[model samples]
Target chain A: MAANQEEVKLLGVVGSPFVCRVRIALKFKGIEYEFLEENLANKSDLLLKYNPVHKKVPVFVHNEKPIAESLVIVEYIDETWNNNPILPSDPYQKALARFWSKFIDDKVVGAAWKSAFTVDEKERGKNVQEALEGLQFLEDEIKEKKFFGGEEIGLVDIAGVFIAFWIPIVQEIAGLQLFSSEKFPNLYKWSQELINHSVVKEVLPPREPLFAFFKGRYESLIASQ
Target chain B: MAANQEEVKLLGVVGSPFVCRVRIALKFKGIEYEFLEENLANKSDLLLKYNPVHKKVPVFVHNEKPIAESLVIVEYIDETWNNNPILPSDPYQKALARFWSKFIDDKVVGAAWKSAFTVDEKERGKNVQEALEGLQFLEDEIKEKKFFGGEEIGLVDIAGVFIAFWIPIVQEIAGLQLFSSEKFPNLYKWSQELINHSVVKEVLPPREPLFAFFKGRYESLIASQ
Candidate 1:
């Protein structure tokens, strides 16, 4: 059963994949949450007080206790809820899930940021190549699995929410091509399936609006450059 | 209650803080394992097979199943051994533990690397200041606690093995100082206590040899530059 909104609250900015991943976890566990929109330009005192170190968004506050860091929040959710488990049960499998998720965070998302977000043309080219190499690793890892977790969305699958949803949107506007069916069929299919997953699709921001925001942001960067 | 050497093996090189932390975790849980040395310059096929993704060391193999990543290995040890509980039981506290360790990895250790390892003199100064600022956060966080885990060495304390042992050695040889008794008194005290902890002390490489290794490595970088 879902908890009431008053007991469970989430503070985050819209369009953030970190926040998106957290929401997916909440919904997966049938946990009801009150989403408090945060303005990144002017960070709220609550956000700062809860997460003094990073001062970033996606703070999940349950009964006034805040949990920061998306992955940490997700793990906390799994640990606390203890239903529809997001991470594997076995020690070794759980370790692999953690390992692959870290790889995604450290390698794939990192390279994707440089490739599509940076204003430097040279850096874009370099990171484009880097992102492609990283995608190859994912392609091989995912293989023919429906998801990284095999027929379910779990830590690695949700950790890769960015690659599943954001990359294509950003790459198109930034005039880049990195992930595609031709290069990585299995990985691409899994990504497509992930975004379209019922739980994931419900919480995802409207595609067109999200795309427009990035489009404008990308153009603004280029215009300013 | 510990697994035997044939059933449990660790592949790594000496002087890697990642490997050192895993050793601390194993000792905490009383896991018996054989150590397999790897020549990083020419990585062994066994290491390659175990950790093809990162190709880094500290691969903990239990029952022929390999687990990569230092923190992941530590978690696996805690989960499998089910003794000397390294992480906090509460979900919120666990999240905080994860967050702080990441802060150590992303902020303090990152800055320390640039400060002491980089050839660029200007970069070193900037990163030296950065590292000191990071240490200030740690000092504040540690305030009056015996360990980050409080009353016992846990995930955060073990994760900070690099700061406790490696930083002092590297900074001295590299002609830099970011963490010390004067600047971060509380954190420095914790570091000293952690390094001297019986379990950690037994596994640590000798100071003289470790110092000499970094000194040679640092001088080589400067000589090449």
Candidate 2:
């Protein structure tokens, strides 16, 4: 535990995969932090002040020094606390971890989310195809490992909090079958193992409530478009 | 230098700021390595094999292992050869560097590039405004510091290679005077310092040819759209 753990505070809303990532990292490092839930519709002054550029959350403040962006915060936690090393010690492996984590964000999540929520049929089809292509790359990368971390929950696994928990539910709600156990057995199994992991399990948004929240939000989001 | 200096290979185009970032890092570290100038229109087979995911350049290969993404490769170089420490040693300060570097990519460069290239009058105006707003943040961050690294050319400075050298010519060729020294004196001065810095100056593409290249590319991109 950090000697200044008492000074740590995380400003975020519940059910955001971005927030969940920071939560998981904090838990993994055993750092005690105040969780200030922000209403996204009406963001607090703290949110605006800490993250003036993005003005969004997973803002990790330690001793009043705020660090926004989930991956940056996660790396900071690992470097600061050195308890359970989140990233690999080797430089090459570390770069691979960073690469895969970024690929998840850029390719997997971006395409998958658009596949789910886009109201236009042609766009959604394009998204679904791109999402599947991205997932195929992930599937090949995973091969037989239970996690991208391979026997430990490292940065890539933590960065993949969305794929493990959120995307499946979103896919189900949006009625877009972009991911399936049949299509991607290894990734499917990896997701199950990741969500079931002790550290990740503790921080997961309760599925029932998250599902209900997204159902309402997704419907309204589709309607607005 | 690494014991395997013979094995370090960087595959990228000359004018890309992303490629320039890796070059700056390598030159800063005083690493002697092979530089493969890639034809972006017809990417090499090695490039294809190395970066199948993005199929893009600025792929840093060390000892047969390739790492894609400019920021990721930069971090890898820093960790691999600790000769010149690119990131701040303090955790909080390191996080700030990462945040600002990312902000440069996500906000500053993206908006500035679009501002220059977008053919639509209204879209270009919006991009111009957003680009200036992004530059304003950088202006305040820079203030009176000689560099983001405070007298040292660090990751943020390396990351903003485009701003220092590429974007000015691009903005000029596109006939969009979005960035001006009068409006952003600090940033403009910082950019001047950065471009003239010994490490940065070595790999920068000649301004005349780069202007001609962008002039052609930008004109064609607009016509195609």
Candidate 3:
């Protein structure tokens, strides 16, 4: 690859777990990429043009080609440069891993993230309960299997790290407990294990920073009412 | 590839768009597998064990290595066999395609489908609006490309097909208009093109049967309360 063509750039905001997903994937693969922090409040012209549809951050640009959506970007990185493969070789096991990953991608952050803004106690409780149900499903389904795919950290593990790392912080920020360590022992243990992973550990923001940002954001969202 | 290791079998309920995703993938790849119809109300033990987690149908057992989740199964089929590839060779294009697929898979089905069941007109309207927004996004993003990845029916096309084929029937069943052909001419036209594909047409259920079944089920759901 030519020098200019070899560049891999990521446009994202700080304190975004979605952006973290792409960051982790790139780090794990040992791929060098320039990171540009976008102030989501005032997105760049390039960001708008590259991703006009959703216009969200964490856009991975590889050799000038832009790929929006974190998981999609991660998959693109994995496919383009095959270093540390995040997916398994066996087709069956790979499918099982993708299944759980998609489940997490679709449900945990997708729905559970909404619990922060709910005003009604009953409605909030329902949302929290639904989120817990998804967590329980993970706990029950991921017994004995080391990382939701059997003894290896793959795409599912990457998707789930959001819940394992960010959810507790989110819970702290929102003053809610969706995953009780006792109720979801397996999930709790898994979270701890994931936190210990070197790649995950390396990329994680300091707790104080994440907590401060999230707590302030939550407070603002509530106070705006 | 041994005969005695239990032939590849798919346990699925008829008329499930999720199941259809797996079916089209299998047929597209020209892979011969046994199709077992599962009665969801009284699910068989095999189906339960095959998909012990979700306990849902559309379980693909390849040499008894059971894999659940429709998109996962489709990807597995595409990877395991190599007759007709579904995803594109270009990594960027593939990522773009998967992003759209995941977007449609997670958003369109959840928000729009849930909207079909709500009692309040306001909530239902939100659902309709969300569905239309998703379709419009597809129209705008899918730039003059024959398929989502440029040409041929890829994963994005597959993802769209699930709702694409059933939305019209669902509208008729729910006595509402969520997917107006006028609003999403490109998507509507794409849906027609998808079903008309020889491979897709072969695997898809007859429109009337699926229409009747899904319509009846939704009606029953609304009537129960």
Q: What is the TM-score of each candidate against the true structure?
A: 0.97, 0.97, 0.89
Model 1 segments more than 4 A misplaced: none
DockQ top scorer: 2
| Top-down DockQ ranking | 2, 1, 3
Q: Which of the two candidates, 2 or 3, achieves a greater DockQ against the reference? A: 2
Interface RMSD of each: 0.9, 0.6, 1.5
Q: Model 3: runs farther than 4 Å from truth?
A: A1-5, A110-112, A115-117, A140-152, A221-225, B1-6, B111-117, B141-145, B149-151, B174-181, B218-225
Least accurate 10 contiguous residues by lDDT in model 1 chain B = B1-10
State the C-alpha lDDT per candidate. Answer: 0.89, 0.90, 0.79
Clashing pairs in 3: none
lDDT of 3: 0.79
lDDT of 3 by residue, A40-138 (tens): 889999899888868998898887888898777777777777777887777776777678887786567766777766766787787887788889889
True contacts kept of 1: 0.97
Candidate 1 per-residue lDDT over residues B1-225, each given as its tens digit: 446644989999888999998989988888888999999999999999998988989999999999998888888888888778998888788888888888888888889978988887788888988888878888999999999999999999999999999999888887666788988889999999999999999999889988888888888998998
By TM-score, the candidates rank as 1, 2, 3
Native-referenced DockQ of model 3: 0.72
DockQ of each: 0.88, 0.94, 0.72
